[model samples]
Target: MGRGRGRDYTGRTMPSPSSAIRPKRGKKGSETPIVTPVSARKRVAPSRQVVRGDRGVKVTRAVTIRRSADELYAFWRQIENLPRIVKHPLTIERVSDIASHWAASAPVGDRRVEWDAVIINDEPGKLIAWRSREGAEIPNAGTVRFAPAPGDEGTEVTVTLEYNPPAGKLGAWFAKLSGQEPAQQVTEALRRFKALMEAGEIPTTEGQPSGRPQNTKAKRS
Candidate 1:
């Protein structure tokens, strides 16, 4: 006769070990959350604060010149005329009606940095704005506005410039040390521009005598 089914002491068929029902593996959604001990948690390093002046530095200057708004606007609208009015050793070459390439001598070296810029806004006899294009050595932007001065005092020209120097704050510091700070440069440029517009020339004291002992003696007649 064939082997009969195995029975336990209670006379019930006993389930074989291999045939016993087991818990089925459930999907990932049914997993329980993991909890790590406080002592075993990782410590994340804190982040550093960003430098404030890294973005750029801004300088604004205003002047009143005894010239009509249209005349000043026309002169300034021509980008090629910039070097004629400013004291800085700057050169600009127009690439198109609204774009130009600019180069200027660095304050601490014989090196010259250049960039291309495009006009972003223009309003005849009112305002003009421009910004440097991508990959510029020193990114910069500027705006010039012309408005009527009080009591027929001619036009008020205001210029605002924001730039990120080549080395950021360090470069700005060097510029200040070399007497080429943007603020001072802008102020002097406007002064020169005013003189040129009103007097038709830039007055200067070149070759003037100084209070040095060697130069105190006059030439014998």
Candidate 2:
């Protein structure tokens, strides 16, 4: 029966030794393995673009006020007094020593948009810087600096600001397209400051009540 089975199996040929055998291993259990093809990696750089505006706008305005540095700095240092001079005065509510909340209305196209800013840098008689708070509708940062003029007889005040309008690119484009002037605003504020300082009086807040009585009646004789 074994001979018959072998004769029948002979009709089918077996696989070659080389094809049927497994890869041999090295003596120390280390064997040469098949190598995988490595893919090439390319690095890409990110583009630098302003999310609000293509390029930031820097506004600088300076004026030589006929006042001493101390006087100019004194008035400018009072952030709460800004409304008296600033063309677009905003209500500033002090929150702490280093921070204050601000609400100002800024022109945007045909209408105005309200912004809430937070005071950042406050150096008496020197500089004041502020930016919009976290949840403000419009984002902006502005600085006001006071320095003595060359002659030391007058103060040279400079104002610089970087604001991201509410409308984003559209607002920036509109501001550029409208040709709306900033000089007038700056000049007006300076004029107001000059008037206030020269008059030797700071503007009074309407919210405060006068200590004197509105009217008094005389006693009948």
Candidate 3:
């Protein structure tokens, strides 16, 4: 007898178990991994925002000066007085009839920043507006307006300044904390200018002695 023969011996064949192996059943303890359906996922739209650093900090300040508008405008035309009025270490040198060069110190270190600006608009005894030239240290523009006060109440000097801070909004906030903010600086400058133009000097407490000088000394006695 041969196994290959479908029929054996007397033309009759016995039934045999199936030649193909059946697949083993899964264990009772086995579990299928749960997959989240794509329809259940949340889709979020992207946000459109104006970056803080890209926008500038705008500061507007006004003060009343007893001097005439013409006189005030003439006084301001001399840019040399700017450094004295401003709290920051800065200087402005005239380049031409309508252009000037500005130099300022960095807030954190010994770096020097320079820029050139051309007067875009100027109305005698009324307004002056300027914008920084191309490739300046930082983008900046400003306008100052002089208006006559009512009832002979001197002149109203309005200043508007805008600049993109290096470190963005956070840096502007930090500068405000340190009293170097643009608003504070412009306000104080106006105050100083008022005092200087009216009183011929800026009042100070430098000569007055303080209650405690011990902290200032390197070594206490």
Candidate 4:
């Protein structure tokens, strides 16, 4: 203690530097955190195909009518007669040389389906094609072709149709359950049209009378 050393009040001897002094520790080793910018990210837009899903309906069918191509084409070109021939509740109003308004049966009587359509192609006595306008009640398009049969069997009428029903394919299936399928309706329409054109009347078990012809006279004199 007398050899140049410091001591506490109660200490008989003070610890030497060799035993008391020690090195201090460095700061804990830890890496800094990093951040990313929002502007450097990738984004994707929606696709129409996914939204559309499986809502398309396509049908191709043909019928051979005992009438000439020109006669069939002329009769079909008169849009007003569609309701009578289609075998469904339908009405067509001509807007111009290329456009028209159409209404067809749906579920109820007064609450029918309606749309506007424009004639896209018109090959006289051969083909007629049409498509519905944008935002229609039921979007649709179709084509009708009239060609001479191989023999004297009149004309071969081929109809091709593609449509997006209001309820899509599901709607078509539902229509089948309700006996309102378009394909069957078209086939029946073609058959009825053939009967009407060739026989001047559509046959019915109800015995309904056919309308008078253009060359009919009465004995009113």
Candidate that would win on lDDT: 1
Candidate 3, position 161, lDDT: 62
lDDT tens string, model 2, 1-221?
32221111113322222221232334221132111100111121111111134333333446667787777777666667778787564577666654666755445554544445555566677666666655555455566777777877677776655444346754664355323433335545766786687776545575555444552223224
- Expressed as tens digits, the lDDT of each residue in 1-221 for candidate 3 is 54422221223332211210111124221111011111122321110111123244544567889999998888777766688887767899999988999987665455677889777667798877676776765666677888988897999887766565556654554465435534556667888999999999988886555557654474456
Which residues of candidate 2, in runs, are more than 4 Å off?
1-55, 105-114, 168-179, 200-221
Candidate 1 residue-wise lDDT, 78-184, digit = tens = 99988987776789999999999998776545667788988877889987777777777666767788899989789988786666555665477446642544555
Q: Note the residue pairs that clash in candidate 4.
A: none
Task: Give residue 3's lDDT in candidate 1 (0 to 100).
Answer: 28
Model 4 TM-score relative to the real fold:
0.64
Please report, in order, the local distance difference test score of every candidate based on alpha carbons.
Answer: 0.64, 0.50, 0.60, 0.60
CA shift of 15, model 2, Å = 88
| Weakest lDDT window of 10 consecutive positions for candidate 1 | 43-52
Off by over 4 Å in 4: 1-53, 108-110, 168-180, 207-221
Tell me how far the alpha carbon of residue 85 in candidate 2 is from the true structure, in angstroms, after superposition.
Answer: 0.9
For model 1, the superposed segments whose C-alpha errors exceed 4 Å read 1-54, 107-109, 168-180, 209-221
Q: How far does residue 104 in candidate 4 sit from its true spot (Å)?
A: 2.4
Better of 2 and 4 by TM-score: 4
In model 3, the runs with Cα more than 4 Å from the true position are 1-54, 107-109, 168-180, 214-221
